[model samples]
Target: MNIFDNDSEVLQIGALTIENGTDSVILSGDVEITKTQAGKAQAQALLDFAQALCAVFDELDSQGLPATADKDPSKVVMVNNPFE
Candidate 1:
């Protein structure tokens, strides 16, 4: 599978799973190489992309974006709306 973000570039290229009673996620791209070589190269590229994404998430978590906030019971509020 190949995933592209809004920038419209090759963001991730990876192998897809196909099994019984399952639908495959088709990727739109030209598979212009030998199966073995293309699979190896794309797999490596996708791994690199995944690592980069993980780093970004880690950075965001470190910045304290309310993800680590304590669960206070008093912060919970209930609102009732009867309009149907």
Candidate 2:
């Protein structure tokens, strides 16, 4: 599934998709990740989560899905999050 915006790079997630009103942020590609309670989590939690996510992407890619998700994809940094 993919969502394309003119000039804005397309976001494609294997067979996974995101629609309007999902309360998610497109960090990169077609992966829409939701913010977690990092404040309450351990210091390594975020890193652990990222590793797990990468693993998932790898698995998905092996299953014929693309692994293009990233925290920073050389995208234009938004001055502010519209959702906020």
Candidate 3:
């Protein structure tokens, strides 16, 4: 008999385990499609977040450095709560 026969009432999709019970399909795992429109939007949001983080770090580095015509080798400085 085929696995899709009346007696068989379950299906697996990637990491998901779906059970076709008397009145419902029970999903046992989260499902994600990396190529779907929603997935692409999520990826783009993540990329934007990463770029924002990099920009913050760059700003902190610039703020900590001094603008001088000559480099000084004897100045000792400490930065506190750069984000604040």
Cα deviation in Å at residue 84, candidate 2?
Answer: 26
1-84: candidate 2 lDDT, tens digit per residue: 122212333223433333322222244333333455443343344355456556755765677864453555577665877788
On lDDT, the leading prediction is 3
Q: TM-scores across all candidates? A: 0.40, 0.30, 0.37
Which tens-of-lDDT digit does each residue in 17-58 have in candidate 3?
656443233558754658988778656654554475466557
Against the hidden true structure, what lDDT does model 3 obtain?
0.54
Q: In what order do the candidates fall by lDDT, top score first?
A: 3, 1, 2
Q: How many backbone clashes does candidate 2 have?
A: 0
Question: For each candidate, what is the lDDT?
Answer: 0.48, 0.42, 0.54
Give residue 46's lDDT in candidate 1 (0 to 100). Answer: 54
Q: Model 1: per-residue lDDT, tens digit, 12-71?
A: 343332121111222444433347977778667656656765675577569764545477
**What is the Cα-based TM-score of model 1?**
0.40
Model 2: worst 10 consecutive residues (lDDT sum): 1-10
